[model samples]
Target: MRVEQQPGFVLHARPYRETSLLVECLTRDHGRIGVVARGVRNERARLQRAQLEPFQRLELDLLLKGELATLRGAEPSGAVMRLTGDAGLAGLYLNELVVRLTGRQDPNPDLFAHYERTLRRMAGGEPLAWTLRRFERDMLDALGYALQLDIDANSGEPLDPSIRYVYDPESGASPGRPGDPHGLRGADLLALAEDRSPDVAGLSSLRRMMRQVIAFHLGGGELRAWRVLR
Candidate 1:
């Protein structure tokens, strides 16, 4: 398969052989792809190396034969989002998630759009927690495991804001007993569902819940970005 001028972003890259690089890119129309960039690490290929950095929008040319595609050409399609500090680390985490969760060559335009927006928001100084939570919510939806935030899974009743709930990875929110350490406030979940900002405590609760859910989906594979960020 040959693709030309595909809009994409490099999720991760690592040195391969003597002067080549192995790249994973997420594209608007082609989900995720594994590519080999020959001679990208050569002394004279600084420009190619720079264009392959994460968070940069690229127009890629590819030739796919088998499992990995050969990166024929890459050029900047737009300005790169300048992410720094924890936001930079968070950006890596997002890339790792897409690489781990998404199937190669599978198309999910919605997730791609959410990822693009999330990165731009992070770079624009939006609250990291809120942006990440939104991405996680949308990511799960794209993966067909959307969280049930408004209703209690066990009782099949609408969640009461006053009540506390424990999120089940498989089923979603259920009423939690008083003093349960893992309990998340129903209000917090509701606020997240509606894309409303919650208090610091609620944000923390959502973070924990999302981590748990994402972990469950990973099926025991650890996210290295979590280690770096933490």
Candidate 2:
């Protein structure tokens, strides 16, 4: 197969054998891909060393054969935003989420653009909570699991901002049920879905709600970076 260049971001990478790496990348045109970079651990392997850092933009050349491709060439297309402090941790969290949720060999250009924009925003020191919430919502939507926030899932009517509601992972938002596992105030839910800054209390409650939703979808595996943030 011929080698072809694709713009991508390194989502995850781990040392392979003695000198190579097994890398997972998210690309604009090709979505997620797995490639093996031979001899990337060598100090003299300049090209491989430079292109393997997470969050950096890269132009990668890979063989088009097999499910796992062989890396032919890689170069930095541009500098990546350097996130620090809480923002940095949040960036890692986002990367982990993408790695978990996105499928290999699937094209999701719109999600890729969102990921790029989100990285820039996080690097600029936006509130990590808000940034993560937005990204989670968008990623779910892109993956076809969009939550129904604008209307009641059971009643089929517009959400009543004045009334409390509960988010059921399987059925979306509905009026608060007495024995539900998780619930949120209508105002907080509305504010979160609308990307508005709710009060601290509301924001805290919304985080819990979103977390339950995310965890349910993730099949109960804890997010390691979130633990760091907490």
Candidate 3:
């Protein structure tokens, strides 16, 4: 089937055979898609680049068969969002996450919308930590692993800002267990839960909590872009 003028972004791309490019794209309606952009590297082509680069929204035409699709045409769908410094790195990290978590041809339009909004937020110079935390929470929520940050897991009550709680990926937040070395303040978790920007300590706690949740799902596979941010 020939899919025409789909909204998407190039999540990743690389050189293909002598004159083509292998491109991985996240489409608004089609989820993560891999396309063979044939002849993109050839001198006669207008794109000139071997592959469409990351961080740009695009309208794409794809020829679908089975696993890999043939790229018929591609053009910028909207203005390219220019992200620099931490924002740029963050964008790469997001792309990697979507690439890893989503399957080809699965429609995840809401997640696609979330991705676009996050890029806009990042490009607008929103604080990296705050932006990252929110994105992590939303991404996890979309994937059905959303953290129970607003309430207690054991008591089933709204979290009090002053209390401390242990976070279990499967069980959500609960009053700190005896001998628990690591826990988050209800203030901090509630701030995260409400999507409020956190203080330095709270942000740190959020980072740790998000890392734990994401790592649990990933089964300890490392996030390479995360290391670059360090």
Candidate 4:
């Protein structure tokens, strides 16, 4: 399939054989795609090297062949973020999440929009924690593994604001009964599910619960960018 001027964002890119590059891009229509940018390493190549960075919108031209496509040309579709300080690190974390979680060539328009919004928020120096958490939840939902947040997973009732609960990665939130593992307070879990800015204590518990859930889906491997951000 040949595509002309498709809107997309570069997820990742690395040097390939000789002067080519293996680029992964997320598109609005085609979802995630892998392309081999031939001769991109040449100094005289028409493609602007700067346009290939993460979070920069681009219009890509390519011809698909099996799993990999041949990039014919590329041009920046909008202004690229010059992320600095903490914001830059947060942007990297977001990119890493997309690279790891999203399947290649799978279309998810909602996820694509959420990702663009997350990048814009990060670049604007907004609070990264809240945005990251919200995006994580949205991403999980888009991938058909949305977390159970409104009611107790075991009890099948609305979460109690006054009681504590255990947030199980496999089963979601449950009453924090005796001998329950991975339990957080019902209030705190509810706060996180609602995307509210919780207090320090609440944030701590929410973070632990989110990390467990994410790690379980990621095959127990930790996000490397998390360490850098910390």
Which candidate number would show the highest lDDT if scored against the true structure? 1
Output the TM-score of candidate 2. 0.91
Task: Evaluate all candidate structures by whole-model CA lDDT and list the values in order.
Answer: 0.90, 0.81, 0.85, 0.83
Candidate 2 root-mean-square deviation in Å? 2.0
- What's the lDDT for residue 87 in model 2? 76
Candidate 1 ranges with C-alpha deviation above 4 Å? none
TM-score of each predicted structure versus truth: 0.96, 0.91, 0.93, 0.92
Q: For model 4, where is the 10-residue window of minimal lDDT?
A: 176-185
Order of models, best TM-score first: 1, 3, 4, 2
Q: Which stretches of candidate 3 lie over 4 Å from their true place?
A: 177-181
Residue pairs with backbone overlap in model 1:
none
Output the TM-score of candidate 1: 0.96
- Evaluated at residue 157, the lDDT of candidate 4 is 93
The digit string of per-residue lDDT tens for model 4 on 79-130 reads 7876788877877887788888878889899888988888888888777777
What is the TM-score (0 to 1) of candidate 3?
0.93
Per-residue CA lDDT of candidate 3, range 1-230, in tens? 99999999999888899988888899888888999988888999866563388888888989989989999888887777899877888999999888877778888888888898999898888898998899888988877777888988888999989888888889999889655667878999989887788799889888888888887888877688879977
Candidate 2 runs further than 4 Å off = 1-3, 177-181
The digit string of per-residue lDDT tens for model 2 on 24-75 reads 9888888889888999899888565666887778888988667888888888
Q: List the residue pairs that clash in candidate 2.
A: none
For candidate 3, list the clashing residue pairs, or say none: none
Best by TM-score: 1
Clashes of 4: 1
